[model samples]
Target: MIEDILSINQRPKMDEVEGVLFCLLNMLFYNDQKKTVETEQISIALGKDFVISFQEDAHRDVFDLLRSRLNMSNSKIRQRTADYLLYSMLDLIVDNYFIVMERLGEQIEMVEEEVIRRSNTKSLARINQLRKELIVLKRNLAPVRDLISGIIRSESDLLDDRTTKYFKDVYDHIMQAYDLGENYRDIVTGMQDLYINNVNLKLNEVMKVMAIVTCLLAPATVIGGIFGMNFEVIPYAHHKWGFYFAVGCMLIIPIWMLWVFRRRGWF
Candidate 1:
């Protein structure tokens, strides 16, 4: 059992062996200052007389509030059986899942605003990162939900009948968290689509400007080509105002095109 808890590749599950109930659970915590999600594994064993828990990270955990409650002489946890203590621990872990979801929601809102105000490479990268994080969240959530359900349905003598209702409550919380994860995944996908469309719109605007400039230069090129031809019969080639006529055509034609464009609302 210790080896299973120490394994990095272990997934959330439940087992009962020779009257001992073993639970391997995943815990998710949100770091607000760093805008990051932290994951850890918690292994719990419920024997006839005692409840033992092992955590992967000793530096941080979501069990502080539970510990404070345990220190109280009149605490309900003190008056309960080992199964109730196990339920309390699992309940705390599930509650933190809600906190992680709330943090992720805030990040999605910020990314949505960034997508709208200015969709740049940085925004795209952040969107991808959020998608990846959501995937991790979802992947762990389903198994934990199943693990809880298994525990609730188990017929082990170690689990107290009175504590079953508390496990059911935790089950409801996990279900809600799963639903919220699905909604957030859809929102992130929509944000990515919005980002792509914004990039395309900007490109189209640049191309439109380039097209208008090209059209205005067409007249100058035609007039110069005609007058510079080797043909001796070219019109206005011998006039005193020939140079001025060509230059004036170059300026006048572009102005005329600009006026036509504005009148038609092309720009």
Candidate 2:
């Protein structure tokens, strides 16, 4: 449904009025300006007797609820002035912002649980993605907060004191959502730090084990190197049981090293 908000300014010129009425009735118009509808600015102006809404896009309107209220036989909108209608529409938009925030909050909670339960690479990647989404959401919401604040403080006759209070409430919700997003960002950062520390600890453990193994083999390697030399003066070289003697040395050296390591609590 289309909602026509007549401005309290001058009535349209006779020639222009027919075209305006035609566009309003047809609900579609072919104009060069219409091509920029999605990127156009939207503004609502309130005058003593009427409300004027300027939309860049002629195809999209933000008055669905207003239209439904207006259709009701005993609707309060019918008895209210244009200012009320404009305020109502603004309220609806602000309400939708909260709805979006609610959904985002739910998603963030799920991500938080995942981060806590598992700090793997996949979880880290998901946290990064959530951080990016929060950044975008914050960017969109910051301006909206400023805009609502402007409306609340503006001297527009369209919004009564009660409506101003409502805007303030909406602003508070926006602030809360912003805070939540920031807190989640911090939590994700902390999770990343934790994951790094865990990986580093595991690496240190493996290195310690390798160092112990190298130390335990040091004596055996030294014995083998001496026996492998072709020198004739080496002890036990001429013995008939020389091979068995070297084998015994190899076994005993490791056992002795292990006993020393145990005594020193190296293991």
Candidate 3:
């Protein structure tokens, strides 16, 4: 095997890339802590009768299966031209897209349940993260689709005419990824709205409870204020058990209100 390497300054640099499909790789991955989706990039370059792949990390690559297949003498990949090999690489990447998307779907369902059961800030943060991830998925995949289409139309001599047909399939897979990202985003946003409504409902219930308690104790406040007056005459002011009666009244008022609330199912 032979390899050609270019230094950073020797290779062409991109200042800005907006949705250029060929220049980007998009993958949806589940985050263990946040349980959200994230994107990983892989770059592939086609050369004379060979392809060179670039991965950010040295530890793992999406091309392991392809590498193994290349070792098999009877494999179609060996029999086919270099362009077919390129298609095989792209197909594997798209297959991974489906796998990661399935995992993301499961994560979304879990977040939806937690949103309903808890509706706390943490759940809100999780769904928000999901939305952000979906956005990134769209941003990355759409341009990749366009770039494939561009390559198909530009008729670049690098890609054989026979291999170009396979790229159309790759473009179709990209569209599917694009649409899935959008749908997941909508689902996440809906979950967010549900979370907000639930949290607000909880706040309102707490407020209602406090208001009821205040109302029930209002009579006690009045009773104490009246007895505190400097006036010579006040109801129960002269009774021997007046203190006990006043306390009894305070207790009874709250109990009655509580019973009323129970009857109405307010609590």
Candidate 4:
């Protein structure tokens, strides 16, 4: 039914009139031949009796509500000019921007929970993935906001004064979405910093404990080295209990060092 209304090939062109032409449909909705919709280079022209709209595709028509309004027997869209239809379509696209932001917010919250509960390497990888996704979204969405802004401020007669007002509403929604994307990006950055700091603190604690253990054993190692030497005149070498005496010294020296450290609050 929509194709029938937009079938320029089948319809006869009336005498050239001067009105704004609005081809406000998704390029992706069309056949596979030209799937990418270049919103920046959207085609618009002035025609004879009515403004002609050449929607490139049929799949992602953001103007469903406008279609429904037009289908109604008593709809203002049917009575109004083509410019009004264009306004309605643009408004729907702007509304969809809010929907996308809502989904993004939920995703960010999930990432926040994961970051807080786990400070592993896997968490850092996940944060990177999220950052990339947000970057792509920001890139795609920024252009859309600019395009809608152009439509609102454009002086083309195709856009009636009242229709431009509707476009302004769409422009505001785009701005809000842009702001949200930026905020999410900042949050991801902060999370990355926090994860790095947490990992570093844990490593420092481990190194400190290792250093203290090595310090506590230094005296025992030195005593063992002295007894292990092959010299024959060592003081405790020839007694019947020489081995026991050496073992006693090794044990006593380490215990005294540990006690001194504890008294000084090193432990």
**Which pairs clash in the backbone of model 1?**
none
lDDT of 3 by residue, 7-112 (tens): 2112211111222222335444556676555555555666557665665565655678988999999999999887688688778777777777787788899999
lDDT of 4 by residue, 1-267 (tens): 344344532221111124434332222111223211122212334333354454445454455776788789899878777766656655666576555556656666876788788788888887787787676556656766766766666677666787677777777877887888899899989989988887887898889788777876776688778877899888777888987987887778778877888899875
Off by over 4 Å in 2: 1-120, 237-267
10 residues in a row with least lDDT, candidate 3? 7-16
| Candidate 2 similarity to native, TM-score | 0.63
- What lDDT tens digits, residue by residue, belong to model 2 across residues 15-55? 11311211111011112332111112345555555656666
The C-alpha stretches of model 4 lying farther than 4 A from their native spots are: 1-66, 235-267
Ten contiguous residues minimizing lDDT sum, candidate 2: 21-30
What are the lDDT scores of the predictions, listed in order?
Answer: 0.91, 0.59, 0.72, 0.63
Give the C-alpha miss distance for residue 181 in model 2, angstroms.
1.1
Instruction: Estimate the TM-score for candidate 1.
Output: 0.93
lDDT string for model 1 (1-267, tens) is 878877864788999988889999888987787677778988999999899988878978889988998999899999889899999999999999998999999999999999999999999999998998898899789999999999999999998888899999999999999999999999999999999999999999999999999999999999988898999698789999999999999999999999999999999
- Whichever of 2 and 3 has more lDDT, that candidate is 3
Off by over 4 Å in 3: 1-41, 259-265
For candidate 3, the TM-score is 0.77
Q: Which model scores highest in lDDT?
A: 1
Worst 10 residues of 1 by lDDT: 2-11
Model 1 spans > 4 angstroms off: 32-34
- Candidate rank order under lDDT: 1, 3, 4, 2
- Best by the TM-score measure: 1
How much RMSD separates candidate 1 from the native structure?
Answer: 1.8
